[model samples]
Target chain A: MVEKDVIVNSDAGIHARPAMMIVREAMKYPCEVMLIKDSVEADAKSIMSVLGLAIISGSKLTIRAHGEGETELVDFLINLIEKDFRV
Target chain B: MRKLTVRYFIEGEGRIDLQLRLYAGEGGLDKEIKYGEINRPGLALAGFFDYFAYDRIQIFGQGETAFMNQLSYEQKMKTYSDFFSYDLLCCIFTHDYVPDKLFLEFAEKKNVPIFLSKRGTTRFITLFVHVIDEIFAEQVTLHATLVDVFGVGVLLTGKSGVGKSETALELIERGHRLVADDMVIVKKIDESLLMGAGSEILKHHIEIRGIGIVNVREIFGIRSVRNRKRIEMVILLEEWDSAKEYDRLGLDDKKYSILDIEVPYITVPVRPGRNIPVIIETAALNQRLKKIGINSARELDEKIKKWIMTEGQK
Candidate 1:
C-alpha cells in the first residue's frame, strides 16, 4: 500500500466538479484507491463517497492506494490535487 | 468523537423530554460537559468542599432547595459564592423548583449555565443519565450500507463497487428496510450494543452506480426505511475468489468488531448467478433463531453422532 497526504489549495475546495474529476482519475487505475480525512476513509473511485468527506479549502487529505501500481496511483492523485485538478 | 457542549445538550430531544429551560448564564452555553455522571451539591451547600465532584452537572432537588430557604440571608450569600467557586459544568433545579435570585446571580457571575426541569429529582436524573450516556458513547463512521432484514440490523460492507448498495436495494425491494447508505454512523451504547444510524445529510439515500442518487423512502415508501437500528450482524460482500476457502458448515463463528463490540460476521462471495439478497435474509433469520437458543448446525452434528454410535453398537 502507498499513501500521500496533500492539502486542498483550491479556492473553492472540492465541490461536485473536482470530486468527479478525482473519481474519474481514480477509476482509471486497477488498484483500490481511498481518500481519508479525519480518520474517515472514502473510496476515491466513488463520487458519493468522495463528496461525503465534505472536504473544504485547507483540508488535509491522504490519498491511499493498494494492490498493483499502488505508488504510481498515489503519485498521480497527489499531482492532480497539487495542480488543482487542472487536467 | 466530538466534544459535547452545553448548548447541544439543551437543543437535543432531551430538552423537551426533561422540560429543561435555561434560567441564566447564556454566555456559558458553549461550556464543555466532560462527564456523564450527575452530582447533587447537598454536602457542598453545608460548607464542605471535600471530595466534591464539582465537574459533574450539579442537581438541586427538594432537599437542597428547602435547605437553602432556611439559611440566613448572609449565609445564603456565602453559600452561593462558595458553591460557584469551582469550575462547575452546569446545574439543574428539579420538580419545578426555581432557584433564588441570588443563586442565579452567582451562576451568571461564574458563567455557569443553570437549567430548570419540571420532573422530580429521581425521574430527572434517570432520564438525564440516559441521554448523557448516548451523547458520550463511542462513535465511528464507516463507508458501508446498513439495512434492516427481517427485524435484524445487518451492516453490509465491502469494497466500493462490490454490490453493497445493490444488495441493499434488493433487500428493500424484498420487504426489508434501509437505515443508511454509503456512510453509516455506528455508536456503541452502554458498552454492549451497537446502534447504527444514517448521517444527517445522507439519511435514507442510496447512490446506485447508474441510477445516481435515489431517495429510498420515496421509492420504497415509509415501511421500507428506519431511522436507526441495533446492528446485530455484519455481512461482507466480496468478489468470488477461486482459491480462497469459504465457510460451508457454518460451524466456526466469525466476528466483526466495531467500537470494541464483536458482532456475528459473515462473508458472502458475489458471483453472476448467486442471489445475494435472499442469502442475507436467511442469514438474518438464522441469527434470530440462534438468539432463541436453537443452534441448527450443532444440533445436526449431535443427532448424527448419536445415530452413528447406535449403529456401531448394533
Candidate 2:
C-alpha cells in the first residue's frame, strides 16, 4: 500500500460534486483507495464516504491505496486534491 | 423494482382483490400506474385540470360519487369525458359504489380502467397506496450483513472474509436482531429511507469462518431475527495497519450512499485484542444519539474552545 498527505485547497472545500469527481477518478485504477481525515477514514471510491469527511479548505487529508497501480493512484489523488479539484 | 399496471393490481393477492373487480375498460388494464400517490379528482370534475395529476389512480369516494350523482345527464357526460380525457391508469369506486351508466360509457370510450371495491374510500386509498409503494420501490442487493443493534439498523460491509458475519453473530448473542446475513437486499421505500432484507435462501442464516452455515433464528430465538429493517448506518471493517492513522476524535463525519440515498458511515479497523462487537454496539448507540441531535464530539470541541477563550481573557 502507498500513502500520501495533502491539504485541501478548493475554495468551496470538498462537497458533493467534488467528492463525486474524486470517486470517479479513484474508480479508474484497480486499487482499494481510502481517504483519512484525523481518525476518520472513508472509501475514496464512494462519493458519500468522501463527503462524509466534511473536508474544508486547509484540512489535511491522508490518501492510502493498495493493489495494482496504487502508487500512480495515490499520486493522481494527491495532485487532484492539491490542484483544488480543477476541471 | 418494476412498474405496476392495472392488470397486476386486479390480479394481485391480499385485501385488494377481496372487493376489487374490473368494471369497465378491460383494454386499459395494462396501463401503468406511474405514481405511487392516489388522487381524488374533486376539482378536476369541476373543469379544473391545471394541476390534475392524470397519472395517478383516481379514487371515487362518497364525496365524488355524490357529486357525480347530483350532476345532470349532460353535465355527467361532460365531466366524465373531461376526467377520462387524460391518460389515467385507472379509477376506483370504493364502498361498492357502482359506476353510473354515463360514467362507464365515458370510461370505456376513453379506454380507462375502472374498478369497484367494497372497502371504504379512506381504507381503500391507504391500502392501494401501500401496495403500489411495495411494487414500485427501488431495490438493490448488497453483499453485507445487516443487524439491528439498539434499534439502529447497522450494515457491516468489507471484503468477503472481513468478519461481518462473525460480528453480526456476536451482536445477535447480545440480544440484537439480525436482518440479513451474507446478502442484504435493500429497497428504497420512500425518498430517503431504505429497507433491507435477506434473500429467501440466506435469510436468518449466517456463515462464520469455520462454523459453516448457522441459523441465527434457531440458535438465537425468534427475537434475534427480523424480516426487514430500515438501514440507518453503515460500518466498513478493514484490517488494521500500524502505519495508517485511524480517526481517533471522530469529529469528521462520514457517509455511505446506497441507491442514491446517503447514510451515516464509519470504518473500524480489525486487529487482535480489539473488541469489535463492543465497538459496534457503541457505534450504534452513538448513531442513535446523533439522530436525536446530540453530538458528543462537537459538544466537547465547543467546550474546549470556550475554555481556551476564558484562559486567554484571564
What is the lDDT for B68 in model 1? 96
lDDT of model 1 at position A82: 92
User: How much lDDT does candidate 2 score?
Assistant: 0.83
Q: How much lDDT does each candidate structure score?
A: 0.88, 0.83
Q: Any residue pairs clashing in model 1, and if so which? A: none
Q: Measured against the native two-chain assembly using Cα atoms, what DockQ does each of the candidate structures obtain, in the order listed? A: 0.56, 0.02
**Candidate 2 chain B lDDT trough over 10 residues, lowest sum:** B10-19
lDDT string, candidate 2, B1-314, tens digits: 34457787568533234358888999898787667788899899888999998898888899989988899988987887778778887888899899788888878887898888989988987777776686578777676789999999999998655688889888998899999876677888888989998766557877665565577899889999999999999999999988989989989889899999999999999997899999999999999999999999999999999998998679
Best by DockQ: 1
User: What is the per-residue lDDT of model 2 for residues A1-87, given as tens digits with 9 covering 90 to 100?
Assistant: 998999998889998678878978887887888888774566676543565567899899999999999999899888887877785
Per residue, candidate 1 scores C-alpha lDDT tens digits across B1-314 of 56677887568533424568888987888887788788899999999999999989899999999999999989998998888889888889998788888988888899999888889999999898777777778888888899999999999999888999899999999999999988888888867899999877678888888878789999989999999999999999999998999998887788999999999999999999999999999999999998898878888988889998998679
In candidate 2, which residue ranges exceed 4 Å CA deviation?
A: A1-87, B13-28, B42-55, B74-88, B105-112, B117-134, B301-314
Candidate with top lDDT is 1
Give the per-prediction TM-score of chain B.
0.94, 0.80
